[model samples]
Every structure is written in structure tokens, then in C-alpha cells.
Target: MENRRGYSVYQIALHWLIAVFVLFQLFFGESMTTVVDAVENGQPVSTTDQALGSAHYWAGLAILALVLLRLVLRLASGATASANRGPRWMQLAAHALHGLFYMLLLATPVAGLLAFYVGDPWGDIHSLAKPALIVLIAAHALAALYHQFWLRDGTLKRMLSPAG
Candidate 1:
């Protein structure tokens, strides 16, 4: 699809794509570890098991790549005007939540890479942060829905589509 004048389609797609992929990882990352456990426990590991085991690392890397792109695009495009008419404190909280999201998104996967590839202990840090990330994600999604429904504002719609 062609890029819109204000909200670039690339940005929109990346945002949602990364979101769904990350959410998938959050929910199902443990299942990926089962492949390795099966082998460790003397259970036969199928080719499919190995492939699925690799997905956790691959998906983390994918999230890193997409988030990097999203950051760049967000900076390049400049964002649309705030549709938030909420209090100043709410706005500050929103910015802080967003900043935390970006930081964790980058740090977690990089830590995973370090642990897997370099035998670093940072992998534990990423593991520890998973629950935190889930909480943040839930808050973010809830806030978006609140803006869309409770506020009856276009803020969430703006993220959904640039034309909003």
C-alpha cells in the first residue's frame, strides 16, 4: 500500500506487526523451550522441535529489527498532534510509559543475544524482565482502548490509522 501524507503506512504496519509478534513471544516463549527440554529429558526431539526452539531467539531478533525501524520512522516523520485532552499528569505518564517500553524492548533482546551468543549473564536480566514487560504491555493496550472507547477520542484511532 502507498504511504499516506501524514501517517506513513510503513510506520503503522511496523507498529502493529511488532506488537503482535512481541505479544506472541510473551505468551508462548516457554513452549519454545520445551523442544530443548525434550532432548534434555531423553525424549526424542523431532526436526520440528528444533525449528520451534529456534523461534524464540529469531523472534527476539525480529522484534529488535522492527523496533529499530519504528524508532527511526517515528523520528523521521514527526508525530501527529496529541489527541489527548487529558490532564498534564496523564500526558507525562503516557510519555514515561512509552519511553520505558522502548528501553525494555531494545534491552531485553540484546540481553538475550548476549546470553545465547556470548555466554553472558545478562540473559537472566531479560528473563526477569519478562513479567515486567507483560505488565507494561497490558497497561499500554488498556490505555489505548481507554482512549478509543472511554475518552471517545481519536488517539487510538490515530495509531490505528494515520488518516485519523
Candidate 2:
């Protein structure tokens, strides 16, 4: 088997960290939305739900910081080159997908922050950011699935294993 280029330690760390944050944001953000809906419909918000909402809010802020750091690390390290063994169209698609990933990743959290500031009344700051995050997450997930299943080009593996 051929050895692939592994991602730098910093890149690996950032990737995993962001993955965790994104996953957490997805779950917790949805939970907060449910809580808000329940309250609006004259249902009581459970203590556990309230706590989760608060946690999500604080976590979102932390995610913002980590994202900024990741962006800086990305700029300093430069981006990985696309795997060279694909068809021209596949290669182009991979590049476009990656570009979209970065754009959505950056935009999602920023939009969430903006939504928070714009008076979303969930009282849980993170819940307010869900609308934007949902769009980004959907985009990110679809792109990943496309590369992994449709393209079968190992673009996902590149990040999962190491950079080449």
C-alpha cells in the first residue's frame, strides 16, 4: 500500500475539535429550538432542557474562538492539494466542494453570532443561532456524503488519515 501524506498535528487537532463542536452544536441547537417551541405553545421548559440551552450558548461562543484559531492555522499552514488520481471533472468537483465547505464553515458561526445579537428571544444565545448553523451543517454534510459515496475519490479519507 502507498503511504499518504498525513495532516500536521495542528491540523488534526483542529479538525477533530471542530468536528466535536459542530456535532454538539447540531444537537444542542435543535434541543434549544424545541424548548423554545414548547414554551411558546404554553408548555413548560424542563430544567434539563434549560440547562442544555445554556450550555449550548456558552459552547457556541467557545466554538467561535476555536474557529478563528483554526482559520489562522489554516492560513499559516496553507491548504492541502487535492488528490491527483481522479478524473478532471471529479477533481474540479472536489475543489469546488472543499471551497464550499470552508465558506459554509466560516459563515455558519458568524451568522449564528449575528442572530444572537439581533434579538432572538430564546434566552439561550446558542439557540438563536440555529437557523444559520442548520443551513451550513446541511451543506457540509451533503458535500461530505457526495465525496464519500458518490465521488468515491478518497477526499474524506485524506482529512481522516493524513494530508498528502
Candidate 3:
């Protein structure tokens, strides 16, 4: 892990791909729930919201595929051995949070699909995961900022720039 200091171009690309799509899904996915509630309440919902809801479904599936690809890349490319510069505790936390990210990224879509096809209970769990993921994302961003800005380290640059 100490020997490797940077990520390859493809690794950085996959990271950004998943990051962007997940954020997009977070922003748009809730509209689907709103539409569902409207329909359940026998209220007239607009076609746009309904369409957005459908888009959310497809977007979720896209996220699933991206996450899977990211995992495959992570495994095949030995991407995790970055020249991590931080306290041991922070490094461990980073790894743990990343592992959680993968789990939730994989599970959230299944929960969403199940909620869509099975019933509302799974939807409730998916709803709960949204906030948790949001928090994790916020923390992740802040950590990157901390490393780049405060610590004057190259952690953020590792993801943003290709390995030399």
C-alpha cells in the first residue's frame, strides 16, 4: 500500500464515474418515492414526476453496473495500494468507509429494485440508506478537501490525476 502512490487513468475514471452517478441518483431518486406516494394516495400526479420516477429506476440500474465495474477494476488493477499519507486511524477509517460504500452501493439498488417490485417495506430501507450514504459522501468529500487543502497532501490529486 505504501509503495503505490497514484491511481491509473482508468481507476480515476471509474472512481469519478461512480461518484457522479451516485450523486445524481441521490438527487433524483427521491422523486420516485414522491410519485409512489401520490399514486398510493389516489392523487393525480404529473406525468413529469412519473417519468422522473422511471428515470430513477434506470439510473439506479446504471449505478449498479458502474459499481460492479469499479469493483472489478479495483480488483484487477491493484488500485488500493495508494501511497496513503495520514494517521493510521484515518487510513483504517478510510478503508472501512470505502468498504461500506461498496456494500451500500450494491445493496441499495437491490433494495430499490425489490421495493419497486416486491413492496414498500424495502423502499423504506432504501430511503433510510439514502441519508446514510449522503453523510458518508459528505464526509468523504471533506476528507479529500482536508487532505488537499489543510494537510497539503496529494490524496485528492491521486484520484484527480493519473499516476505518473
On lDDT, the candidate that comes out on top is 3
TM-score of each prediction: 0.83, 0.66, 0.91
lDDT of 2: 0.67
Candidate 2's displacement at residue 139, Å, is 8.0
Model 2: per-residue Cα lDDT over 1-164, one tens digit each? 22335466677777788778878877767666666578668898888888887776677777778778877876776666655655788667656765665666666666656655553532454344456556656776776677777878675676677554
Top model number, TM-score: 3
- Give the residue spans of candidate 1 off by over 4 A: 1-6, 32-49
Q: Compared to the true structure, candidate 1 yields what TM-score? A: 0.83
lDDT string for model 1 (42-99, tens) is: 8877776577658887888999999999888877767545665778898879889988
Q: Which 10 successive residues of model 2 have the least lDDT summed?
A: 119-128
Q: Which ten residues in a row have the lowest lDDT in candidate 3?
A: 76-85
**Candidates' C-alpha lDDT:** 0.76, 0.67, 0.84
Backbone Cα, N, C clashes tallied per candidate: 0, 5, 0
